[model samples]
Target: MNKSARFRQSIDFIEEHLYEDIPLEQAAQAGYTSLMQLYRDFYTYTGHSVKEYIRKRRLSGALGLIKTSQLPLAEIAYSCGYSSQQALCKYVKSATRMTPLAYQKSETCYFFPRFDSETIRQVTVTSETIPRTIQLKFYYPKQRGIEHQAVAALRTLLPEYEGRIFGRDGEPREGLFCYELAVEYDPEVLNRLAGSLGQELTEVPEFCSTFAKTAVRSDESEIGLAWDYLYLKWLRTSMFVQDDGRYFEEYLCKGGEVKKLLLYLPVRKRMDYDKISVICCADSKFLVSSREGEQAEEEASAAVLKVLSRHHPELIRTAREWYVARNGMIYTCGVRLEQAIELPADSGAEVLLAAAGRYAVLESSSCSDREAFTALLDAWIQENGWSKEDLPAFTTYETGGQAEPDAITMRVWIRLKDVKNG
Candidate 1:
């Protein structure tokens, strides 16, 4: 609902010098942004170019000046940052599609993001996206006697909850029990858990960990239709959903506090070409309503491909096709068999495969059914300044691969380069 600090800074400069010939160099210097970096950062967040923004602002101002002042058109143009009226009129027509005088005679003005209070939508501008440090961790199974003790231990950490812990009733799968721990993001919780576990738990074997900046989007929908859109953006573009990606939604003003819902996307993966897999899966219907899942599945691939075509469409120059498969929680992206471009053979692929980005990690709310989780993902998209353009092309895979659908976990993986960008 509001702009980021950088965008605000840009606007501050724009507002103060609207009538001046402010170039990209000046704005970048004022904000300490490199030219290329500034372009991507500004466009990604605001969805507009700096010059385009200035042009819009000028058009909006020119009409006001014409309406109320006796200033000459040339003077008005100069005051609005145009070096000459001819140049000004050309841009005005480019924007309004009519001469300035002609448009003024018709008493026209410019408006963007026109919407009512209830239906308001916001475009987010991110601060310079910097890498965050976090531990990439995995959880191994505990001994039989420790299972009960672990449950009791967890209760101490998350007490007063009515829901049953997964696998508490029956034998859970073996291996490490994946517990996401972060001292930086959740220092209090981490410190508390560490103290509670004490020296006795220090010997527990842990997985790997790393620090990286991840994308954090928040949405809530009865069906994960919106989440599908966000995924659509991710695949289509060279975007990253970092291991430590976080999500949170604000519900009210501080004094009149409102509910806040937050979720973290755990990632700290390396794109090892040798370990990377070109194929992965996701279940679309798991989060989205059956109808919505079907609708999203229909366009699932369109989502990711859009990004691929937009940025590295050249990747597709060899294999000009894409595909996605998902039923509820699982969605898979792969190339058509006929369009087999070179899959990586480097050691990096192996590393990538081991990392979270290597597989086709599909998200499902294991705690709830597909409908509930899908709806939740949708709400995230709306609140988090996300749109389909932000996600990858998505296609629903067929369901029931001889596995219990409910037991299926939510996972997705892509190459490190497919995601990690500033």
Candidate 2:
């Protein structure tokens, strides 16, 4: 078999038998290769050692169950192939700073995005939320090109105010590239900077944000891609909408083998807008598990594993989770390509096509946090002056490339009807 097929086979085997005590030899056999070859290929493709990958996947699985299901911790641990609930707890606390019980009690979902590539930059993206902050911002026009001079002057004059630098292109003023160099404001520092450096204090209101840190020098050049990826891809589908506020990048440590940058964009959980984009989704096959109620369809999604074990063995490890809500009924599912061998024909599987119309799309995980979804909906409806139609909402999953686990992006679309006029 080709390299792609081998990797798929290996992943499929691992995912299939994740609940079982799978040996390396068994995984290799599933991939139709020697253990050594499987080891090398798995590492190359996933940037994770076979053992590490299995552990992380299992932990992720355990987390999902812990967060979404009524299942007991011991049951979750056993189902995720852990020796005991204590083992699961130890790993959970080690990886995330919270215990399983603590995590479950909290309103936050611990399902952060995962990275799967070795060549790409190794940057960690984490959610940053602060209630209220005030900053003194200094502006320099692009034409003057005095940003460095301004920064240098401020650094020299106030030496203690080593603030962050922010850049903006064509906003508030046309054809002007401006930098909003900011320092966490102290009345004393603000007074000193204004008197000495002559920069103004700009009010940056309370908001939630995201922060990215570049881990290695090799990952430095790729940091720009990470920034673009977050802004272009992540923000669109996220619960938060970009507010009319400051967006900036801060250099944490300069001229070091290990570099760090904190990119900040001011965001509100949602905004009201009556405008909607009419989208046309192609007809596709979905391996679905049916569910009731408005909760995230994680329980129903389990059906995907069963379908994979039977019908489309190739996609067992490869497909990302998906969801389709018809007439408000949720179906936890994943998309299947047409070329893949068709099975589940008699298994009550369904084909879905999202009807084209005006839709308000929120990009989130297939199994998204319920609170976040509710907040987004409330804010969106209020802001848009638009109300939902009778049509069903659908969540679509795109991995962006071939079968890479961490490449998933889930988008939920709510159909809107009739714009309210002011």
Candidate 3:
């Protein structure tokens, strides 16, 4: 199996046996790798060591049971691999700064949908205008490997995040649901120091905001519940109201069984979509296959595979695929340029510059048929009263970006008119 698949296997093993004692050897064996190798790669991929990840997961799991069930604390502790109730309480306090009794009381007194209200440490309210932020746009769907691009962006733009992620969920751009993962930097300083990078800029107006962090895993419904609480409960009770502006979620680390997500929702005293500044795309390097015509699809596939085999055979790790339309034709196979290097001439692979500008994006899985995909995009564009722009459309593969042509998933991007000034 490929590295991504192997890593998934290892994570699956850990999640399955989370309530039990898991040794490093077992996890390594699950991945078909060595202890040291798994240890190193695990940290690189998940931003947490095996031991640390397991501990946090166990605590979170135990806390969930404690809040929902009538089971005694001792039983919950033992079931969650804790030695005793006392041990569970100690661990909980250390992690969340709350005792079991206190946590339970808070849960009883108040709640935030799927999450316990007490677990919410604090919701800091701020009413400052958000400065211009730089973000890399990419697609995130209910699939694998797409997140790698986001991680790559974080590493390139914000090294401080390490492998951790901080992102703003964006509405569908083009025909895909695109996310703008912000680069942590002062926009003014970046513009002053390197104004060229400002092409990736987006600005937000002043608004009232509530911020909270939770040990909730990304896969859980509680994450959505937290958002719902901010909107349904917190915002409903406060004087502030949600505007058309986008809310943000900062992921401290990539999702596994343990993730600390800082959720933020900036509410406005009044709606101000017009007051908000429009954000444009940043310049990007794209490695695209150029084949167009009656046989373009077949020819493009062969060309992309040829390029990969010659220059980047290592990228053939997964079956992810991507495509985009341009000049009345399609580029059958695609990947962001930074993911690959050392392109050989006449191999059907060329580096193209993608200009910074507005675009509509939409996410589609490999499983969807062409008609369904197109229909979805059509509905979204029409409903939102959006129009296509004069720029070329594109897509990026979610998998290794090279594989058998049929096994790929992709995100499509269509250019949009510069509506910010309009």
Top candidate, metric lDDT: 2
Please tell me which predicted candidate would have the highest TM-score against the true structure.
Answer: 2
Q: All models: lDDT?
A: 0.39, 0.56, 0.56
Tens digits of per-residue lDDT for model 3, 81-122: 998889999987765566887876542211111111221223
Candidate 1 lDDT by residue in tens digits, 1-422 = 23355545655676678777777776765656676766655545434456655665676577557544679989988888788889878876766676877766652333322011110122233433222222222234654334335444555664543321221112234554543222122344345456454222222232333221122232235113433333333211212334443432112112222122122122332221111112323321111111134456445445445544654466445442234434454444433323223333331111101223322223432322333233433332332223322334233232233354434334222222333221
Model 3 residue runs over 4 Å out of place are 1-281, 318-321, 326-332, 400-409
Rank the models by lDDT, top first: 2, 3, 1
**Model 3: number of backbone collisions:** 11
Per-candidate TM-scores read: 0.30, 0.34, 0.29
Question: Which regions of candidate 1 deviate over 4 angstroms?
Answer: 1-3, 112-422
Q: Score residue 282 of candidate 2 by CA lDDT.
A: 43
For candidate 2, write residues 1-422 as lDDT tens digits.
Answer: 66667767778888778778888898898878899887666534543457766776677668767865799999898888999999999988866668888977754433322322222333333466543323443444554544445456556766654444433332334544445555554567656665555545565555565543333222435555666644554443333455675566564535321145555556554432111232334445565667666654665666656766777677765655455554455555556544535564666455555555556665543334433343455354444355777665566666656646567666666766645422
